[model samples]
Target chain A: MRQEHKETMKRRRRNIKLTVAYDGTAYHGFQRQNKCVAVQNVLEEILPAVFGDSIEIAAAGRTDAGVHARGQVVNFFSDGMIPIENIPKAANRLLPKDIVVTEAQEADRDFSALHSAKSKIYVYQLYHSKVPDPLLHRYSWQYEYKLCLADMRKALTLVTGEHDFSAFRAAGGALGMNPVRTIYEAECKQEGAMLTFRFWGNGFLYHMVRNIVGTVVKVGNGRLSPDNFAEIMQAKDRNKAGKTAPARGLTLWHVNY
Target chain B: MRQEHKETMKRRRRNIKLTVAYDGTAYHGFQRQNKCVAVQNVLEEILPAVFGDSIEIAAAGRTDAGVHARGQVVNFFSDGMIPIENIPKAANRLLPKDIVVTEAQEADRDFSALHSAKSKIYVYQLYHSKVPDPLLHRYSWQYEYKLCLADMRKALTLVTGEHDFSAFRAAGGALGMNPVRTIYEAECKQEGAMLTFRFWGNGFLYHMVRNIVGTVVKVGNGRLSPDNFAEIMQAKDRNKAGKTAPARGLTLWHVNY
Candidate 1:
């Protein structure tokens, strides 16, 4: 009877998941690295303290340096018994103010954060003003140009369908990886002097969204024609893409399951 | 004729005005202090470099420490002969990224940045969430409470007319001064998980808006009835008000002349 109780206890303690949000400006990335600040490092340090045991965390996506996340999903396994209601407050006390665990829930043992994500959304902000506003300097990229809104919208429409986005991938992207991705939606809108570009996709190639934004900005500024955007995608040449937009302007808005 | 020309040049140089914006998170306030970083010190250092003369700048309002500004107007007198067109770029190059001179124009000789303003608008942001997002830490105050939107709106309306808001003024404020001020409008709105409080008035006393927000928050949380807010105003006692909200959440949104 005692042996049976031990086995049941072990089975019940094996599942836990947490949804986190972080201002990634201060970390190297989402993955852990030696002698570098990463989101995983922060979680590793705080989760162990909260759970009273060393915990391994798995995330939905590994964001790059200076990329912020609003809804980053993470999962972990734990054996110690603690009320789930205390997880957010307990973890927050040990973690820095820039990393917050918004939700914690028990998951099935087979659940994997990375594999379970159905889609992701990213937002890139650009401020089209003659002069940069000091308040928005950290949150947006300043583009001092008169943008043609119609041309930008036209270019954005072409990016919505599934396509070989090799033209938008970075030159240093991984080898033997498929660059075909289905973009559910791509939209550009201007609110006052701020231009926001929101993209939803099944998955993205390395630097795909940033490069696409850079190309669309060129179209908005009349430097590149919107009609040529489709041709550029068909060519599948990385050199045909515009420059990568700065990472500071990019935000991981949400991850959908 | 040379003496008359010198007088005319001096007169023309004395009429200089600049519209400025600053991210006040890093500064003590708009005014200068001995051991603190202030917006005035930044402007003081850059003004002489841009105009090549000692200039005294008077602002439309004195924002406290950690308070941000978007359209804080200033006027300065300089005998230097630099073109008005060159002032914006030249000063911006010398100033830090947090401070910007958005518009520079010649003004009437008697114009004062503070006295010439007709009205000022201030915005205070409150994040009404169970947990604060890391990205909004510097820009908003996090409060965990279910706010009654109707009660907040009702309390906002009570403070919209001309009155002596001594109850809203900070304790130990200037003595023997009339706290009477005309509030053009006071509004509260909730967007998503954030609540915004905006006040437009001819002038504000020390910590007045923040004090008022604190009182309104009490009404919002049902700690104080909305009808009681008028009684608090009539009492004209600082002790009758709620706690003072932090300065970081307040912004000098704009100045209307």
Candidate 2:
């Protein structure tokens, strides 16, 4: 009976799952770094203050600087002193104005945000116009040339499915790690002068999405044919891809896990 | 013939009308203020640099701090050296990143953005949720309440048509000026958890739209019945009205000339 009580007490140490959202314009990235403001640093700073105890958190992905997030997930072990319903309010009061803890849930004690088995959705917005759109400037990239949606669709086909994405990966990216990733969904949706690219993949390299978007834009501009794009993909060379797209236009939209 | 040529040259000193948009989170307001940064100051600083000389300007209405603008119009007189088409690019290069000159056109020299206006449109955004939404923090107000849409719509009816809005005006509103204004269209539009209050009027008193929104929200939450709302409008007393909503939710949506 004593042993059973101890096991129950151990299970009571709750794993708190959080769905977070941030503007990311004023953050270095999602991970904590030296001499920089990160989303993790702020969350770490506030959690201790709100709960009156230090806590460690693990995020699903390390989003780059200036990359927004709507449904980024994180998890941490807690003593379960604060009620689940009040956790969001308590954390938001101490967090920065640009960062918000949108949802909080008590999960199994063994749950881990990083090791969850599923995919992620990232979105990159681009607009074509001579004049900059003030409202969308912080959230979208502005380009001059009008892109052919049909060609962009053709390019998107090359990005989907399982593949060795070394050609689309950036230099200095995750050394010694495999570059194989399966893209579940890749498409460009147009609304007026804006084009939104939505990408859902099992995993991504340091700059995989941005690099793919750049190459697809080249295809839309009539510079690269579908066969040429396939060549760039099979080349297994980083230099074969087009320029890396801007970070401000990218958003970590959702995590399927 | 000399007199006619002089008049033509005088008219050639054309007035440039500009359509402006801005994210007002970082600005004190649309008008110039001491010490604090204002959208007008940024525009004033950039205009001279782009035009190669000082240029005075006027806006349709002075938006409050934390208020955004999508179709705010401004006008200025200048020598037609910088070609009307090139003004947006030149000004945008010098203006702050938050403010944008979206459109520029030559207008009559007698045109004034503050005067010669037919109506103005203002929009207030609100979201109902228990937790904070980081992506919309700068663009909307989050309220924790289950609001009745029918009650909110009924409240909107009490706000339309020409009426003495002394009850809705803020303190120090125009220094004993006429409290009566004509409202052409006023309604509440709901899209999911988002509620948008649109107001079109010949003119608005200081804090008029915000005050109306607060009252409408009160009605939505069942604090004030539709009859109580109508009484507040007819009471012509600021004390009878509900509280003024936050400035972040307000936007100067458009100005019709």
Candidate 3:
């Protein structure tokens, strides 16, 4: 009877999971770095106190510096001793104000944060105001251009399909990684003075969404034509793309698994 | 005839008016002080260089330390011959990047920015997020309150008409200033995670809008009821009002004459 109880206890202790959101401006990225602010570093430091053990977590994606996340998923193995309902409150108290564990749940032992993702949505915000509002200075990129919404929409239509987006990938990006990806949707809209570019894809290449946004902005500003965007894509040369937009405006909107 | 021509030229040169916008994070306020960064000091230094004569600008309203402005109006008398069209560009070239002159126009000889008869509008922005977005760290106040819209709306109704707002005025405010003012409109709206408070009035006493916003927020958070707000206003004592909200979120939206 004692041996049977030990087996049941082991099975219940390994199914905990956590999902988090963070403003990445203060961290180097999602991964831990020596003497650097990182999402993982903050999580690791607090998880030990909550679970009473050194816990290892796996993130859905590794984000770059200054890249914010709204629904970034993370999973970890933890014992069932602590109630799952109290996980969010317990973690939040130990974490910095810039990061929060919005939700937590119990997951199967075989679940992995990386392999569970099916699609992701990203948004890039741009401000075409003559003078930047101090309130929105950090959340958006201020560009003094008369953006044409029709032109941006026309250019976006060219990117919504399976394509080897070599033209949009960052130069010297991850080696041995395929540049091809399937984009489900892409569009741009302007509300008053704020312009937003939203994209959904099965996966994104390095700097892919930002590069696409930059080229679309060029089309909006009359610097490039929509038809020319098609040509640049066909060229499959990274240099043929327009300049990359700044990182401040990019946000990981959601991750669908 | 030559003397008359010279007098006419001098009269034309003496009328100067400018429209300025500034990020108030780095300044002590709009007024000049002995040892502080003030918007007025920055303008005073640049105007003389542009006009080739000493000029004193009369502002529509004076903002406190850390308060921002977008449509601030100022008129000055200068005995110089700079073209009105070139004034905006010249002032922008000399001023810091945080300040900009969007428009400059010649004003009538009798025009005074302060004495103009019209309404003024102010907006206060609040970010109601569980975790602070790093990008918005300096721009908004991070408050984790489930604000009640209905209660806040009802509380605003009491202050719509002309009334002596002595209860909402700040201590050590300007002397002999009548607290009676007409509030033309007050609105509260929420977009995504942001809450904005807009007020249009014939005039505002020192810290009037901020104190009102604080009280309404208390009502929204269930700390003070809508009916209690009426009681506070009727008491006509500053001690009865809620605490002053931070200055960074307050903006002088516009001044009309």
Candidate 4:
């Protein structure tokens, strides 16, 4: 009877992973908050009703306020027997129109959506235009000035591979945290008025992508040269970087397990 | 003195044209409403403040609620002398984030934005997926079933050329309105999960694009045949067609001079 009860407990506690996508325009952020609504709070509040289980979710990244995610991964142990295929549809029925659970899968009990991820890809979108575009405002930033794509490309090459990114960290980041991170790839692509910056890294420090974009925009606008960009990276001081770009322009694009 | 005053009045009544774009998710519709906020209400209220004159605007199309527009045209008479180049910038400063005046130009005094348009183009967007996509919910309709694009394309050809389209007109449209209209072009393009239908026409009947889209989607899903679509067009009966697709999927793409 003891062994049977233990097996039943093991069967009940299944680790389920969900791939979430959100507009992020309405939520304060992906993390839970006290007074303000966040993506995390919505998920936790709504998921229990769908799965009939008390739940806690661990997300791959805690995106800041106004930040969006297309392939955000989260894992939680479920005490209910809802079929894996039905999870997305069930959760989506209860979630708001801005948030969606795109996919769900059962994983090994030890799988961690945060720690077990190998890398993540983030994309920052901006459009060069004299006037704002309403359709693109929720997903992209608008810059009135023209950007030199060649200069931005040259500066992007400096961000590849492992390097100390302390200069790119925001002011309120944890003290004594490791500032070195491996950026497998960094690229800039332009199509007409739109510019996209893609970054693939093992892990990113707080506000790292926005800082890099800000400093890179400076280079694109001829305020800083590629050499100056290199110097800022080597300085390892937050004050050496340019202003942080707005959160709405960045999206957590994908995560690799 | 009387002659001079007449000349001054003529000069002050210069006609101006604006190319407008908006994300219509929050608006009631393009036309002004008694109590509900609308795109027209926002524009009429703000443009007058920018131009320093009481303004009246005539738009190229009156889009329904939740329908977006990328190149809606509007013509208005301005008594003030603001530089044409600065009009977009000045108006955008006071306009809400969801609406923008993209361009401004002086037009002929007799030019009418609604009556002088040669043709207009509208696009309907939809995506086939098992689960809803949060990023696209505002701009596209999500269909859970697979669509046969080839069949949809075949049916779209029937929509081209001059036709009496009373069957596609929505209820409450002007009674005894002429149903004969020229469809300059009708085409469908599919990429991945997205399907876009483009209609270029001299003029579309009320809910014509939406009603056609509803019928075409039914054809794509195998509920109706291309022959059935042709018969519906010939029937000139609203009851013969499928349901009107949601307004969110339709966009006023452009207007030709």
Candidate 5:
């Protein structure tokens, strides 16, 4: 790094961190896309209007379409003089109703929303009912048949700790990316007709959480035993896992720094 | 009643009751309107398709535009041969995604959904936040100011029991209708930033619940005292009450027969 460029960057207020929450049903995804509206596109357009400076942001996770987030981290560099406390308030007013800037703060010059050390917690929601609920359809998957909660619990227990998750990664994932990741916690809890599966992990491959949820649901439905789930994990083949669950059921719950 | 009309009505199967749940954002209201789409319009259209006979339904309440319902009750006389259990399943398949038939059953020959002796429960939802939540804005009213819970509770106590609630009635209410009604239960409960006001009553005059809510909110925000709220009720004039809260925050919770 050039000393002059480093000194220039250090003297200016360059890094701003923001926590965002969004309803992803109207967005294409978290990343910017040329042909479709994305969360990033809206953020980039609104931040400039709020801060009086064009800004580019880096996000912790690029969530897929129809996947909501309650605590998505983002960071950008801006020399504009808006107070950190007012950024979220100002941005929220100008941004579309589907996106919100929940928190904002000044950060160290070199900090990055993407490169920051962190683990994430994701939750997949499901409700078992003979008839679907109109109010909950946007946020949860409605499954008609009764599930074997005991069998699904066993399947989740096998999902904890480090493993090569090749069997769960979707195609078109980054080339040459490592498939091994550590899963700190994987558990399912049911209350009456509603069920929630929460997964906390250091990192996850594309579609890993959804694929695992789909496979665990099959076990709950008695199509496969706990042993079969273990075997699929050991096989380390994407074809061995079940189909990915619908995107509407998934929510990026939080990120732990 | 004529003997032949009575015998023919008694001999045929009739009076099927339905408990419906709907996301009312897409519909103008629960009643059929000439120019705009409504929940009743959709229900009336879809019921005939499912029962193979034209059906006219009577509802317990006529909810206003953008007002939701969790357990709104309706009844229709049908001579069709579809089994009782299959009615909901068949209607659900034919109904729009925003409306659902949650339960259906057989009712007595003389059942009249609107005229049946019954009470009703209504719930109004609110959340206090500096920034509006896009996801919850459709279902809950977002108030930015802090509320005095103690004052709100005091106002709710005064709302119970039978009273001539003309102060809370809106314009265009039924002509010559009795304004006095019995409120069996009236209470407000708060959890964190969320507040829910529930009213169980023999009947509600048009806009009575919403007008009372708006007036009580004034007391909570220090604009009016609890004594002022009681005075408003005593005034027995609509102009003495506060404005009506938005329709989005109100829901027809349930009907008791």
Candidate 6:
């Protein structure tokens, strides 16, 4: 708004960080692909029309297909003088009903959505029921068998803190190929028929959270004990761990910056 | 199967009442129409095909287009011996993703979906926010204006007893043509940005619950006062009430049989 603030960036355009929320049921995922329609593709298709500029963007998470998000972050460079207050409502006007930009803030030119140092949180939801609830079938995994919550909580303790997560990682489009990560918290909460697994971490390897969930579910189901889960983590072998949970049950909750 | 027990009715079919839940966005209301795909048509189209018989069914509430329901009840006479426990899952298999048969039970021929009921409950959900929430926009009413909850609760008290609801009823489809109905319970509950108005009544007329919600919203928004609400009820004129709220915000929550 002021000339001095504009001069601080030296002729470069302003960077905007937007908070996004999406249902993700109708999307291919968060990352833009050539043939498939992703949340990124939807934003790319609509944001340009609103801003009148070709914009390149970066996202906090590249969620797999069928995965949802409530607090995903994105950043883009724009030369237009559109007010930040107008971005979210204007973007929603053109974007599809499933995806929406919730918040828009002008950021320093050097800030990034994926980088700039922060943690992230993800939640995995399960509908514990003898019969599937059609209402929750789209958003939660339906599990019919009995589960030991105490055993699952004990199994959760085995996955936290800094660890070499090679056992949990699955081959995917990860840039650094890093296997070590810092998990700040791992907890399970059950309310009525819905059970949620919350994970707060500095970073996660591909499929790490889901793999941990699968292993913990085995512990809860009595297929594997809590001590066995600790052994599985120590083995550092993907095959030794339980199967990876489905992407539909996982949601990227929030990104810390 | 016990043939003697069933044969006591003498060629009469048993009536089955189904507890149905649906996201009614794609439906043209609950009643069957020749031109559009209604929930009734979908049920009629699928149920007969599943049982190999032409079945006529009736519902407790005929929800409007774009309205949702959690506990809508429908009854159909059937000679088929499909297990009651298997009906819900079996019906869901044939039904579309939006509508689901949640529960089923066999009832005597005297039980009617529309008549042999004590009361019904309805809920209208409102999402209060300055910006639209994409995830909730489908099922909730997005309202950005300021509201006074105390005044709304007071306004709610004026509608919770037996009264001539001519001020609330819209003249359309009526067989008995009675304007008198008894509201058993009426209250407003707020959790964060979502406000839910719960109404339990012996019976409701055409657009009656929605009409009351519209008037309550007017009181909340300060466009109409609580005293004016009482005066409007006494006037017994449809023109004295507020505008009819949109169908998308209303849901058939439950039925007492």
The TM-scores of chain A alone, one per candidate, are 0.92, 0.93, 0.91, 0.95, 0.94, 0.93
Write model 3 residue lDDT over A1-257, tens digit each, in one string: 97785455446467566777777767888988898888999898999899986676778878777887777888876663778888887888888867878788887767777788899999898988875554455457888878888989999999999998999988968857888889999988788899988999999888898899999999989989999999999998888788988877888878887
Worst 10 residues of 1 chain B by lDDT: B5-14
lDDT of 3 by residue, B176-210 (tens): 89889999999988899888888999999999988
Off by over 4 Å in 2: A1-12, B1-12
Provide the DockQ value for model 5: 0.62
**Model 3 misplaced stretches (Cα beyond 4 Å):** A1-58, A75-101, B1-16, B22-29, B33-58, B75-100, B127-147, B190-194
Evaluated at residue B49, the lDDT of candidate 3 is 95
Best by TM-score: 4
Worst 10 residues of 4 chain B by lDDT: B5-14
TM-score of 3: 0.82
As a whole number from 0 to 100, the lDDT of residue B32 in candidate 6 is: 94
Spell out the clash pairs found in candidate 4. Answer: none
**What is the C-alpha lDDT profile of model 2 across B150-226, one tens digit per residue?**
99998888788999999899976775689999999999898977899999999999999999999899899999999
lDDT of model 2 at position B247: 92
RMSD (Å) of each candidate, 1 decimal: 4.7, 4.6, 6.2, 3.9, 3.3, 4.9
Poorly placed runs, candidate 5 (over 4 Å): A1-12, B1-12
Q: How high is the lDDT of residue A195 in model 2?
A: 92
What global local distance difference test value does model 2 have?
Answer: 0.87
Task: Return the top candidate by lDDT.
Answer: 4
The sequence of per-residue lDDT tens digits that candidate 1 reaches over residues A6-64 is: 44644646678788988887899899988998999989987888888777778888888
lDDT for A4 (candidate 4): 83
What are the per-residue Cα lDDT tens digits for candidate 6 across B1-257? Answer: 56674445335576889999888878899999999999999998899766667777889999999888889999877777777888887888899878888889988878889898899999998888887776677678888899999999999998989988888887564746888899988999999999999999999888998899888899999999999999999998778788998888889999999
**Cα-based TM-score, every candidate:** 0.91, 0.94, 0.82, 0.95, 0.93, 0.91
A71 Cα displacement, candidate 4 (Å)? 0.7
Candidate 4 lDDT tens digits, A1-257: 97785455456678899999998989999999999999999999999997887677889999999999999999987787889998888899899999999899998987889999999999999888888888889888888886788999999999999999998999999868999999999998889888999999999999999999999998999998999999999988788778898888999999999
Docking class of 3: incorrect
Better of 2 and 3 by DockQ: 2
Distance from true position, residue A60, model 2, in Å?
0.4
Question: Chain A TM-score of model 2 versus the true structure?
Answer: 0.93
lDDT of 2 by residue, A1-257 (tens): 97785455455477889999999999999998879989999999889776665677889989999999998999886675888998888888888878988889887776778889499999999987777877788888899886788988998998899999999888978768899999999999999889999999999988999999998988888888877889999998788778899888999999876
lDDT for each candidate structure? 0.87, 0.87, 0.83, 0.90, 0.88, 0.86
lDDT of 4 by residue, B79-147 (tens): 878889989889998998899999898999878899999999999998788878887899998888868
